[model samples]
Target: MIAIGWVKVSVCFILSSLLVACTPVTPPHTEYDWKLPKGFPSPLVPEDNPMTTAKVVLGKTLFFDTDLSFNQSTSCASCHQPKFSFSEPKKTAVGSTGQKHRRNSQSLVNVAYNSNLTWAHSGLNTIEQQILIPMFSEDPIELGITGHENEVLLRFEKQHYAQLFKDAFEDSQASYDKIVKALASYVRSLTSFASPFDEYAYQNKDGAMTDAAKRGMELFFSEKFECFHCHGGFNFTQSSQHENQRLDLRPFHNTGLYNVDNMGAYPLSDQGLIEVTLQNTDMGKFRAPTLRNVEVSAPYMHDGSLATLDDVIEFYAAGGRGQGINNPLKSPFLTGFELQLAQKQDLIEFLQSLTDHQFLNSNLNYPPVSH
Candidate 1:
């Protein structure tokens, strides 16, 4: 009886041990490893489309796959190239069907944090919605997927993509909703935070930036330059949001890029946010893009009018371009400021310091197979 009682106690102990061992050591979560820079918070994610490694893999493959296009002539990378930090050198983007877009392709670096997507469209608050314009906008005919969506969907039904879809969505069926979600996940993963500025500012590495760049950084944040008003914070723009910050300012400003009619009016071809809102007060208003990878993604402004960093600096120094200087709707911060030659060089150096080579050189930035 004593031996049997001892055996029962041993069995109970073993069962309890097994139960504890079988339990998860750490809590299970849907959180993704963003590999974000120190002190940088994770980007805000949609509740419906939680990020996962499988989605990233599938989305990355689709981002570069020309098969997603109806004609297979152009892919997302055609406009947003990896070498240029996902923004091409073109003044304006040309669609798959050879239709021309009005605005330049914005860089995708750290785009996940942008409060507003695109330059002037206030309605386009999400990357998933912005992506649809390129895929199916009949007026611009970007990927020309409007009528051929069925055809394009059929192409991804192959075995290779089937497995990817299964892994991403637990279903092997390829649909546009899943495609957009996957692509969004891939774009969200395209972050750049390894720049010299990040080192000096965030990582406390004093020697990362040069003296001139450091001086320029001070000047950039100073009241005299007033650059921080529009282009400020970690991402260097007011139109930014993250995990800790729920501020959806969606700030847009009229930098007086153009004033054709001389009545605070932009050109008839493109009038910025006024067209969307049909409000004259919103004339020439556009979202201020993040300056994270500005050095690599050249040809500045919404129209890509300024060819170089020097030209952009000069444009702001002179107040605006052509008649845009005297425009009534220009931002209050656009008032011309004096920048000496040495100071200009310093500012340029500081802007260049924002380049992130690590993010640019990552193999993940490249297509699965060379395009």
Candidate 2:
């Protein structure tokens, strides 16, 4: 009887060991180091797609990979170059199929702090949603990958990407949803806060900004210039938010760039927020982008109408073009102000001081090598 009981116990133990061996063990989740700049608040991250080092690494690879395009000719990096603060030098971005985009590609610097993703769309609240437009939209065909989803997936299944996807996501399927999430993670990590302006303003570093730039900084935030009304805050934009922000601000202004019929009418093709809201009052209203890297992001404005920072400053000083017709829809802050030639040069220097050379050449922002 003792021998029989021992045999039964041994059999049960063996069965339990087999069951435990067959069950898959989930790997531990990786915690990402945000490396947020001093005086900058944390960027709000999505709950579903938490930031992880693995995801960021995978996203960077996908961002520079041409395979995401239908013809395998272009990638997100083609339009948003790192040297220019992730903004293209062209007036407007040219798509993968050589289609010209009507709107200029906005800079992605500190994009994680933006409440709304695009120049006019308040609905595009997240990078995950905004990325879909450039990748598959047929109206302009940026990546032209709408019908080639399967082909793209197959391309991603190549040895290099397959391993990356598996390591990042724990599943190597290379699905579209995973790609979007990873790309968004990489973009959100492109933060710039080591500029001369930041060093002086936030870090208490003396002589970080030149005397000319110091004077310009005062002018930029002064009530007389009204520059702060639109491009204010640490990120230098009114339409900005960080994790500590209690309210999300989506301020849009009609800077009187155009009044086609003297009726606050913008160009028929691009009517700014009116395209989404269908409100006449909303016509020509566009979101103010961050002026952090404005020095390098030339061909300024939503449509790249202003070719240089000088042109931009002049446009504001003159209270914007066609202001007589579009004044009603323009922001109250657009009342013109005078600046001496010296002051103008100082202001330009101030803007240039906002450029962070470290960020422009950061190894983390660059494309990853294939292993």
Candidate 3:
């Protein structure tokens, strides 16, 4: 009886051990690693679609995949190339269907810090909302996937995408929502703060910037130039926000880019914020994009009319391009000022110093390697 009782106890112990060993081990949840620079605030991320390594990886793959386009010829990366700080070399973006976009393709660098997503549209506060226009808008036909939503989703049913979607979302279902969320997550991760200026200003790294750049930085922020009034914050734009920011400021500046008929008209087709707000005072008003990586994102301005940074500096020095047109709706800061030839060069040097070489060549921002 004692031997039988001992045998039963041994059997129970073995069963318990086997059960414990066979139990499934849940993998640790991946924490989103934000490699932000010193003094840079945390990017405001959507609560619904939190950042994750798997999601960012999946987003990168999808961003580069031409399958999202109807003709399989263009992807998000087509317009926003990593070589140019996620901004194309074209003055204005050309869509997948060969249609020309009215506005220039804004750079995605530090886009997560932007309170407003696009140039003029104030309603597009989130990346998810802003992405829908590019992917589905028939007016510009960016990706040309308007009516072929199912076809686009069907492309993701392949084994590779299926696995990726499952890993990223913890579900294999490929939906439009999932696509936008993942894409937005990837775009938000396109932060650029490792510039020479950042090193000199925030990192306490001496000799990171040249004397010309340092002088230019002073001029840019000085009351004489008043450049910082619009492009002031750490992101170098007033229309910026971060996780710590209590108030989101979406400021639109009317730089008097145009003043047709002296009525502050900005070419009927591209009337800036007036198109959205229908307010006469809002004419020619557009969000000032971050000056970060401005060296690479040439052909500056909302319309990409300014060919070079030199021209841009001259335009500002002259107050605006509309010399004769007395536009009252222009920003109060548009008071003309004189900048010496050497001072202009210094300003240009300062702008160039903001170029983040590390961000431009980041492997993670590039297309994923094909299997």
Candidate 4:
């Protein structure tokens, strides 16, 4: 599933009220060095599972270890590989036993900032809670840990894991709780802010972006383009929430992907949020993922139906998918746009600038050497 696909520095700090502060800022949790980029706020973390070096190490090891799977055939990296911005090349996810998933596996980049989890769920917010679907859910049987929980857990009782457990939880024992907590910690650590856009925007390095990319950036933020309405903010998404966030904006939109009855109904296999809330208005709705590292994390959209960035652009330019264009549930922002050939290429070049090579290192996917 892991196909080929995918840092810069920034300065400038803002003080409370009117003054500007250049003082070194550190996140409240000190054990883990977030290494956050300048100008970005500290990520909101849950009090129950404070991030730590030991836990991150344990989680990273388990994340890549296929032994964590029921059949030892899959790991978290199977669906989310580091090379593809923590996403995969497959159109959709395939479980350990080759059970096909209903929706596309979204890239996990900057997931810690997401206020909502999954493609449509409004309630599943935390990384710890969302991870349970893969680790234990019997529906699609991702890790297939439901029936074989004890057997799979016992595998981690070895001396190697014993030390890891002890260092992380102050006990030489492993449990589902420890595993979930550690896995969440590792995932929360994945933050990308070294893109050319970051350097140009945050560090004021004008030379960081190409001339065409710069022009495209202007168009992206312009009101006429309206791209920033959903994919806005420092993270390039409206669904983000950081430490300073006060508004609980869990925005989901219907991009008019389907209209089988001319009633804005998406495929029954996966109709987005309507499945959970059972609300008619929520039909064909899905979360707009962060555009960071969007260059590599393709075959896009909730169903992985769009094959390329150009296709996605055309979809938006034409308002929506053919029949769905007239769906009443479609976002008002998707009214359509006139895109010129030159403009399309320029927009793509800007998207390509979002790829962060430094963040795609092997350390996030490969396990450390056994002691």
lDDT of each: 0.85, 0.84, 0.84, 0.84
Top TM-score prediction, candidate number: 2
lDDT of 1 by residue, 58-152 (tens): 99999888887889988898888887888989888899989898888888988898878898887887889889988888988888898887888
Tens-place lDDT per residue, model 4, 89-171, is: 88889999999997788898888898888889999989999999999989888999998989999989999899998888878
In the predicted model 3, the residue pairs found to clash are none
Report RMSD for candidate 3: 6.7
Can you tell me which runs of candidate 3 are displaced by over 4 Å?
1-30, 239-250, 364-371
TM-scores for all candidates: the values are: 0.88, 0.90, 0.88, 0.88
Report RMSD for candidate 2: 5.7
TM-score (C-alpha) between model 1 and the true structure = 0.88
Any idea what lDDT model 2 has? 0.84
Q: Enumerate residue pairs that collide in model 2.
A: none
Say which prediction, candidate 1 or candidate 2, comes out ahead on TM-score. Answer: 2
**After superposing candidate 2, which stretches have Cα over 4 Å from the reference?**
1-30, 239-249, 323-326, 363-371
Mind giving the per-residue lDDT tens digits that candidate 2 earns over 179-267? 99999999999888899998998889879999999999899888799787678788888743434433334578788888777767788
What tens digits encode model 3's per-residue C-alpha lDDT throughout 1-371? 79976776777778778884433335546467789865567888888888888888788999998899888889898888888888877889999889999989888988888878788987889999999988999988999898998888898888988899998988888999989999999998888889999999889987999999999999998878878877978888884343443332447878877888776677888988888998787888898889999999987898789999999999888888854225777776777789899999999999999999999998444544353
Better of 2 and 4 by TM-score: 2
Q: Which 10-residue window of candidate 2 scores lowest in summed lDDT?
A: 239-248
